[model samples]
Target: MFLRAKVRKKDGKEHRYFSVVENRRIGPKQQKRMAQRTVLYLGEINDGQEAAWRKSLEVFDESCQRYSTLSLFPEDREIPAEASSSIQVKLSEMELRRPRMFGNCWLGCELWRQLGLQAFWEEKLSSQVQRETVPWEKVLRLLVVNRLIEPGSEFRLHRQWFDPTAMAELLETDFAVAEKDRLYRCLDRILEHKQALFVHLRQRWQDLFAAPFDVLLYDLTSTYIEGEGEQIPQARYGYSRDQRFDCKQVVIALVITPEGFPLAYEVMDGNTSDKTT
Candidate 1:
């Protein structure tokens, strides 16, 4: 890469404009060639110090090799340019925060966008109050992505997970959207459209995969509750999957496609058998 001075003869005056140019190599190794391209145009010589400008950019590029980012904003002309112009260039550095968590958040957000979950939530959520007050879809997607990457509860997400993550920058929103209660409320809103969401995702997956979603798969799981008769009737003692036969528990059945797209789910009594479910 190098700086180029373009000569412009306007009305018989020799005017020169500067541009940063780089050579791009393409094609097979045997047919490789350098193609010059303009990277940046530093228009006309307004200050008549084009030499100093070139020296500054060259020095800036050199500094990039040494430091990725500067810690704080500094006054212009902090570094002297040893060029043949009476121009003392001005430059300032801004501290850039690129958390390693950005890549994980970015992949999650892109997947959420590709699934059209954002648009779906915006359109399918039935409550007018929720649509106006909370970004139910965005929050829910964030929760899912965070769970996949970090595996934490809503409380952990709001209090700890949000702080070090690049979610704020990626979502272009502040801490209010990641509040604990707000994240939990997103679950309540989404459950209202659970069946519709499943159907929607199945169709979306079919379109994405470009194949028929054939073959149904069923799965059953059970979890026990530790509470002692807190007025919950469905909580019954059953053959515990975890061998906690004495504790109250509940059964859940999930129906999914061979492509791993969930179609429906059922929550049943604790003693419900796999055959009955």
Candidate 2:
């Protein structure tokens, strides 16, 4: 199925027309021939007419279980109401299911590409030759995208968020990429490449935005854990930024350029002083 365009000369001027067309293979296989059938004649559409058509477009909101008109143009743009394409849907026969988030996940993937994290991780965390069920880099991408989009724990992403969102479709993999153990394993593997990952991101920022690193800003913050944190060596009693002094915490320090590009970060013992850091 495609759009077919035709041109005709009238009054010494070429006029253009468009129609929805479908290509069909006609006759037997031994004498096969291609034929185009016009499904709908669109005639000549002007800008105003097109805007009107777009203004009349509707989309189904599965979450709300309702339909709303879609706007192709910005909210400030005025659409002409002189023409419209109306569609009739039978409410009784219609069913809506499997509502997956798409826009934010797509944007997350695009940002990941723009930062060159895909290739960087692919090289850093190369897939093993043991016939891995899913690429380690892709799994890492899923984790990063989950953080960027919803900012949830790996457990939540694996149990609740993965199936409901479009990450599976966007990442081109099945539920294996979001498996609970795989997420944790991917994190464990990337710890060794932390410094290299920071360098790669810094270079990407410089290349993409010409970001300057001359003026570096440093800051430290502490995040307290709810439990005793006995198993974690770094977790200790510290100055609580969140006013949770009773709980064990870890101090996180970060260095960034003036333009807000992160240069480096460190996770120190909770008892470490800011001045010492």
Candidate 3:
């Protein structure tokens, strides 16, 4: 890969933007053509930053059959580097900043997109006003991704996980998406779409993996909640799987394919019998 510069004129001034790019051949063998694909965007580097980047950048010397440090700028430019393309760095002075977890977060987002959930949620959770600061779709995506990667409470995600993961970069969103209030509010809004979401997921699973629907496994489980659960009518003293008979609990019924793909789930009153539900 190499650094490529793109020049744009705004207000009669020429501005340059830089990106790391690589060339690839595409199309069938007979109709193959070379194309440049951008790997990363480095917006508007000044002379000093350019010099620093050049000092650390490395390139492969095809003729010499070895890797060598080279300046990104042209030879005529006033940049600091050895004339022969060799440079030295004081490693001790360098410091890593804002290092965030990326791979799992990226995978989660990619899987979300692959399942067509991005468009699905965008349509279902669209903002009513033009100036809506909250990107509901992205907020929901963040919650789903967080749950998939490291299941945690919205509070933990807001206070800890969001900042440590690369969700912001992946979603093109900021910390606002992880705001505890917004996360909770988003949950309140999605219940209406539960059935639709299940339908969409089922269709996607079938389309992508050809998941079978002929045979389904159904099961029931109970989880107890602490406190009085005053606002939750479904929370009641019942058969607790955890043996927390003192605390209120709710029953969850799930139907899944033999291959372990969830088809549907329902949360019922703790006292609801599995036979009745």
**All models: lDDT?**
0.74, 0.81, 0.83
Model 3 clashing residue pairs (backbone): none
**For model 2, how does the per-residue alpha-carbon lDDT over 44-139 read when each residue is reduced to its tens digit?**
987676555444444556889997644322244444464365334443355769999999989999998889888888887775615688988889
State the RMSD for candidate 2.
Answer: 16.6
**TM-score of candidate 2 versus the correct structure, residues matched by position:** 0.68
Stretches of model 2 off by over 4 angstroms after superposition: 1-92, 127-131
Candidate 3, after superposition: displacement of residue 229 in Å? 0.5
lDDT of 1 by residue, 107-156 (tens): 99998889888788878764554444546666777798898799977899
Pairs of residues clashing in candidate 1? 77-90
Highest lDDT against the true fold, candidate: 3
Give the least accurate 10-residue stretch of model 3, judged by summed lDDT.
Answer: 71-80
Query: Model 1 off-target regions past 4 Å?
Result: 1-100, 129-133, 228-233
TM-score of 1: 0.62
Provide the TM-score for each candidate, comma-separated.
0.62, 0.68, 0.69
Report clashes for each candidate as comma-separated counts.
Answer: 1, 0, 0
